[model samples]
Target: MGSLTRLIVFLSIFAAITLKSNSEYLLPITKHEPTNQFYTTFNIGSSTKSPVNLLLDLGTNLTWLNCRKLKSLSSLRLVTCQSSTCKSIPGNGCEGKSCLYKQQNPLGQNPVVTGRVVQDRASISTTDGGKFLSQVSVPRFTFSCAGEKTLEGLPPPVAGVLALSPGSSSFTKQVTSAFNVIPKFSLCLPSSGTGRFYIAGIHYFIPPFNDSSSSIPMTLTPIRGTDSGDYLILVQSIYVGGTPLKLNPDLLNGGAKLSTVVHYVLQTDIYNALAQSFTLKAKAMGISKVPSVAPFKHCFDARTVEKNLTGPNVPVIEIGLPGRIGELKWGFYGANTVVKVKETVMCLAFIDGGKKPENLMVIGTHQLQDHMLEFDFSGTVLAFSESLLLHNTSCSTWTSQK
Candidate 1:
């Protein structure tokens, strides 16, 4: 109740948070190589008319377009609750309620598609990278194919329904399902400056790039779940100055937080919190109470890497925890980095367009040769120590407290 009493309470809480009972370490190395790039194109029937340079996203199998952003199709119709020609995707007859064009909701009642031809309104969705939000133009425009060939076992578009069920009977469900059917794929965006692939690889002769510049292109790890957990970038662990590392709350991948969780990267890592806001206010769904980092800013390095550290055969990223676990490279102190308890994970930082980059994490042979996998289980609490546990060599690569 008093000032001194309040200070004591605060200290007690802080102690509870900082205390470490036990810690774990994940494999510190990873492997990577070249792979193919995946792309998708939509054409009317069997014509050479590729409209949208749509990226093939098994995560979004349903082929669609920015309904209003189309180049004026010959005949396109917008389905409505009240339209004589409106019809369900056939067979999906209404139980009691009904409509002429009953294709079910593609984006659901609050469908991801909503834009009036007359009023150009777009929907906002945080992109997969968690870097920024995108306002997708919408007017619900799917090309009116006169006669389009459907996927092998699929049917063609009839009235309003296109056999383009995106794979599954349900429209939106297909996207995620397709991606799941094939977990990993690669695309070459040499222009975008990203190169690294697990299975599919990439097509770009893209100059090897890194998170910012200090390192080379780090593969985009994907984590799977439902819509809410869909667009996650599941990185095994990050790096700093050639060492496995952790990102502080202030410099968290999701640019710290905003008013609410614009996306999961913005999702707070209570276990990984470094600095608390003075206001002590809880953040919104996709937001953090901490300060924000520069937008779209990445790390950079102008100096050449040490040859020994960048040598081949050395596992840069090791898999599994310590002990007799599935480790990639041999275990050695000062040789292969033995993640210490409460150590800091290096980040991908870049200075102004002026000099050599400092403090960057390079994805060496370990990340390249080995696989960036995801278990049905892993601790959600990521911290300096959590980074260690992630490289646990058979769960025994950890500091046990008894």
Candidate 2:
């Protein structure tokens, strides 16, 4: 090969490597307090950059939006049913020549909506591992467009659901394929204000948490394989105030799944066990019990609970999971354990999923707030930082640093 040709090939390869190494995307997450739903905003369109807010849903497969409300985009193209993209999508169907997709609304009300698959330009912020760099266009980003009825049960302004499941048509898979980046994403859902959703990036945190110049310490656990496409992990035990709950071994057999949908939902038996244990612990702590609230069975007087930097000084709830060495525990402090419903009233944040529930335990957004969760699809493992509040930091801290 000629010298100039060799030099050009080397430069091309070098540029590709540099781009992949620093190609991280950031999406700011906002918490809707009233609905307890979390959503993120990004620009979608070609000629016009229209900002669309979407709920961050780990259960749904294909990302869908109320596209009828969106103005016509010059770059929008329909995916034909015979295309390879349509074939790869789970539960895909055909409507004439267009690729038809039916997506279950995450809100559960007005259950499912069928739409045609479409691709358009979407804009997102790119980062250089640690800092926000510039706006980048994701050309031909594939998503489905739903009608107005699908918007029911969804918080207003939240145009649609951003599917982050393990399915082929998930937002994570599409982004990974488009950028040739790591097949992983991290979420730091905030209790209030804004947090961050990072796509294929090195996890970075502000000091005290990272003064040693390392990623925040995370407990690694295997992601159990399932046809459901939900992120499931094994929970060996549950503890209140460091004391293990006397749960039937079979109760933990189903495994616990992580969700962005609802607050912690435990099976009837499991909920009874946990609530009973927590009540006893609270009694010992001299925390006064109040009348139970609607969704929550255990209510307490917020005035009686001591205040701490981390949150209300309540007994820590720990979830024990299988780790590389011995078992690892993810603990939830007062910030994540209890929610204040009214003045002087706070209740345990767990909800009863009733008998014969689909999953034994579904860890919800309430317990996940202020904590960093890395979902590594390539590794089939989840790396988690228990609570940022414990480190005098929060999910918002990551965005503020940028």
Candidate 3:
């Protein structure tokens, strides 16, 4: 049998050996207090375990946790430079007798988080309500330990991060490798209801999403280069009210060049183009007195827009992918797209991604509030479907024109 088949057979036996009687486990995720950052609680260590809140990041790879005052620090098994796991992880080297790992931000915009690599016993709630599932113990898992110092951009109280990227050091790769299962997972974040993060075998699916008829299918474009880790999708053209904007041809190419990175920040050039096109069309349709808001160049009068959140006269923004795959549309009524910044001022949430060559276009997470995105690593595809729950308070109560 092939290696993948052999591994699957091995996991079937291991599951019985471990007495973990379940085909899947769900990690309940919640929004960070006062912020949109998504986080989940993890209980790590051995005898004296402690719970820590970690940010769920798709852009990052390695999972790092604060180990400054971890009560079970003594129980961690430090990986040496000679180990195979150390070699698999990039930027790993021997410091005296310790195996140290480093992930430096190519851009100086963010601080570098670095530390030694070690394995420990960790636990996580496997239910939607954060109920502890005794069978799911992450034994002998490798991760980074961020001592007392604070990491750049990481806010207070949020201990560290749980990276869900496809990179070598990512948590998903480690988990699947340890259990000998196919490396695949899915995330479903609703606008108001509970969200679920899943790590399962080849045919990974949440309860309701198992039906094939309930999902919209699309191909995932692999991002080339050693630096590309997050799920990046291809774009054929972008249109504002059916009118195509002149975008760089290289960005829309079929082969593995950079398409947009799916994240929370949008590159300046792309955002500027969309905002300019949308704003110009709005003014021409009888919306009077156009004014610019700092940070967000495209904004309208809050008082006038309050009466009509439908963004009447404003065109629907559509991003088209080749092969008639599908178009991602943004109507004016969604959560963060059109937000009220002040009592009298409301602005578009899209912001400039500063001057950076690699600051390529990114699809903000807020845009996926009412959408279900599936990242199928085994098939190399990204599937998307509109959420079943349509009546979101932050969004327009009227039926969407999807």
Best candidate according to TM-score: 2
Q: Per-candidate TM vs. native? A: 0.29, 0.95, 0.77
Per residue, candidate 1 scores C-alpha lDDT tens digits across 1-402 of 699999999999766644311111111111111212122233331112224322223233123333323345444543443333223233222223332212222212332322211111212222222122232222332222211222211112111122222223222222223222222222221111222221211111112211333222232222233322222222333322224434442332321110000111212232122112211211211222222234312211112112232221122333222222332222211122211111221111111221221112222211111112221112221111112112322111112111
Indicate the residue-level lDDT of 378 in model 2. 88
User: What is the Å distance of residue 358 in model 2 from its true position?
Assistant: 1.4
What clash count does candidate 2 reach? 0
- Backbone clashes, each candidate: 76, 0, 0
lDDT of 2: 0.86
Candidate ranking under lDDT, highest first, comes to 2, 3, 1
Q: Write the per-residue lDDT of candidate 2 for residues 63-139, one digit (tens) a residue.
A: 99988656666768999999999998887999899999987777846777798899998888886544567888888
Residue 97 shift from truth in candidate 2, angstroms:
0.7
The deviation in Å at residue 349 for candidate 1 is 5.9
Query: Model 3 clash pairs?
Result: none
Tell me model 1's lDDT, rounded to 2 decimals: 0.24
Could you tell me the TM-score of candidate 3? 0.77
